[model samples]
Target: MAEVQQNTGGDGKKGQQKKMQIRVDFTPMVDMNMLLITFFMLCTTMIKSQTLTIALPSNEKVDNVENMSQASEDDAVTIILDAKRKAGSMEVDTVNGKVVPVVYYYFGKPGGPEGLGDAPETIAARNNLQESEFLGNDEKSGKARGIREIIQQRNKDVLTEINKLKEKYASGGFGSLETKEGREKAQLAYDEAASKVRKDENLKKPVIIIKSTPQASFGSLVSVLDEMQINSISKYQIDNMTKADSVMVIDYQNRHHK
Candidate 1:
């Protein structure tokens, strides 16, 4: 708001000029600005930051060797990450200046039923390493491909239970999903139930052991771990590649590439 003040001429002089002053009130404008800021703060929605959560290995020591938990041979699955190699050499192969990743996996053991013996002939004959790709879902069918398909098949039991839980949650078995508060509560309950199913002793879940070659990119390792999470796997660990693992890989490349 603005107001004008006029002063009368001095001593009633005919030629004297009148003086004027203007005043503005900004308090109302300040109050309106404060209200606008408050309205935006209350009505605006904030975006949540997306992140990948991974469980790290514990540093606690065990007193007894027998007390250590081990995966059963029937349920063990080993995945090896490696870079693509040239036709007959150890040189890494690249496509469009990007290192191509290779995935290998085996069930039960590295050298199949007989195990990896020191003899070269035995390794050549019994090596169970099978190559695969990091293919995603097929566009037309929406079905998983390559390594993702393998993990999903091995983790069928846990995934089946998780799917059942999803159905139950959608049907309001855990809680109502109508309101924001109700949705949050329902999600918490669903997560707890899924965790229990993953850890259940009766369920037949595969224990995955991830290994990587020295030339393998860190990105490849992360990709394999992503598969574990996407497939709802609970029993998995990152481990060092053994001598036998190296032998099998070299022997495989030699036989196949040549």
Candidate 2:
């Protein structure tokens, strides 16, 4: 009887052991999951969205005549920023004029020879010049001068002067134009362009119209504006064709489940 009882006890112990076999040790798995979560949390970046601040024209009511003639050829300057190129390029266009190539110089890189210089001074000096100088002035000197001819002349003169300065710098002359001076000159050239547009006889009080793609960043726009030396008298407007009544509707019931 004692032997039989012992056998029964041993059978019970085997059954308990078999039941315990299915149990898993999940502590290591839990620890690994925690570690992965922490790592991902630390590695992930918290992206922040930024909104561009632009002053829009007031929606005040005006006389029909005033509204009809709000923008005169002389009153507004148009700047077109196109990022559609394989490498983005900015072009400036006038009310009734063809697109003119405008170069943008970054502080650190070797930009095109067209646009480069420092701040307000160079730009201010440029503004004093007549539009004919940029767009092309008809030479009264009985010489044939088209817009392209004038542009070429200006480019040649500018490049010649710049090359001389660069050569001087290479020769280790202390009086040579430094990088800062070059940047300043470039900015002055851009401002001069803006001034020409504003003072153009073809337009009245020139309004600066900027046409930029959605892909264009605010920094690019700001840089151009800064170079132009635009002030309180100038007005900036955006071209958005979307209607105010447009609304987006989504239907969730029709969505497919994979």
Candidate 3:
């Protein structure tokens, strides 16, 4: 509510002035401001979440050999993601302030010639589980470290060409980098060049098969996928883990926890 008080200024033969004092109650205004602030807080978009798109093969059993594309042992890399678990239990293990992700990788196949073997003893012998972490780019060289470095090494042929394309994009070779539209055009050109690099027949590339345990965090899955994009990997798929995968993980943890 607002009110105005009138006061007489001065009196003269033929001139007089009147003054007005306005009193405004700010209680309602404060309430209105709070409501507006909350409204915007609820409506505004904060951090945009990133997602991965994966295509799964049909559930139907395929009996034809000619239709299947088989990857040779030399070209396959199997990556397994698991959460840090208790010593010998299935409990979620965390260290510091974050959920630690344990990575296991093998050059080819789940198990060697004797494929997971028959018992836990043989499984441990055949288990190729190795531990790694999700680390960021190096401070000085800006080169990716940790598992990223390992992946980049395997996909060096593809990434070598992609890096050239990235350089070209940054230098404004595709279009002017000053404007948004030009940036978009440049990005499209870079993507096409990167795709061509991935499809190059002369270069050798590894086909990655990513498997995750149920206890693995979604953030870790995204981190691994980010490595694929950063390295310009062409062929990769998210697959369900098998019994051998579980046995290997548990056995490795049990042996190491001691």
Candidate 4:
């Protein structure tokens, strides 16, 4: 509420009209503005940070064979993550204000059948390590690019159904995408669809085993995990780098660095 006051000044000149000035009280307005600010500050929602929830295995070894998840060599894809190294040195390399992540992957075991076998002669032939990098979706096609593309290619059998689900989601098959409540419903529906595809035994999906070097950035690790999620891979897990995994990464970097 506001109040107005009228003031009259008089020189009292003959036949001259008197002037009136109106003043508006601003104290109420100032108080109202403060209250509005406080109310908005209290009512506004803050964004929450997202996280990946991983289930860790127990320390004790499982005695039951049925409890362990086993994979055949044909269905296994091993992804090794490392920080790009300087030529002729083990030093980490950076590019464009970011730590460069080097990715090497292989189907089946490290060093192939011989398993990083006895010596250098066999190691060279069987190393089986191929390099790649984490890349975002293509600007034009909107399809995933880089390492993501490679993984998706291997898991296309599952992606065929997942892509359909994506199309359904975009078309509002789950719910209206325009509103907040609708988006939530759509996401739940999408998750359910993808989950069904992942668990479908009839569909063939690659089991990705992710191993990272100590020198790699946490961001790179997260980026790789994002690929797994984006690809709808249900069988991937974070695993420790074995001696062979470490050796293969070193050999790949050394040979390629030159």
RMSD of each: 6.8, 20.9, 3.8, 5.6
Against the true structure, candidate 3 reaches a TM-score of 0.78
Error of 2 at 217 (Å): 9.8
> Per-prediction TM-score, please?
0.75, 0.25, 0.78, 0.76
Candidate 3, residues 158-231, lDDT tens digits: the string is: 88878788888888988889989999988988878878889988999998888898888888999899888878
Q: Model 1 lDDT vs. the true structure?
A: 0.86
Candidate 1, run of 10 with poorest lDDT: 63-72
For residue 14, model 4's alpha carbon misses the true position, in angstroms, by 18
lDDT of 2 by residue, 1-258 (tens): 011112334457554633322345678888999999999999988987855456655565454235334433333433434322222222333333333333211111111123223443433332211211122235576432432343233234333444454454456443334578875665565456545544444432334444444444555566445433323223445443111101100011012111
Give the alpha-carbon lDDT of every model. Answer: 0.86, 0.38, 0.79, 0.82
Question: Which pairs clash inside model 4?
Answer: none
Model 4: residue 4 alpha-carbon error in angstroms: 12
Q: Write model 1 residue lDDT over 3-104, tens digit each, in one string.
A: 888876567778677677989999999999999999999998798766667665654444222212353276788899999998878999999988899998
In candidate 1, position 146 carries an lDDT of 98
- The list of candidate 1 runs beyond 4 A from truth reads 1-72
For TM-score, the strongest prediction is 3
Poorest 10 consecutive residues of model 3 by lDDT?
Answer: 63-72
Model 4 agreement with the true structure over 93-136: per-residue lDDT tens digits: 88886899988899887787667886877777688999998888
Global local distance difference test of model 4: 0.82
User: Which RMSD does model 2 reach against the true structure?
Assistant: 20.9
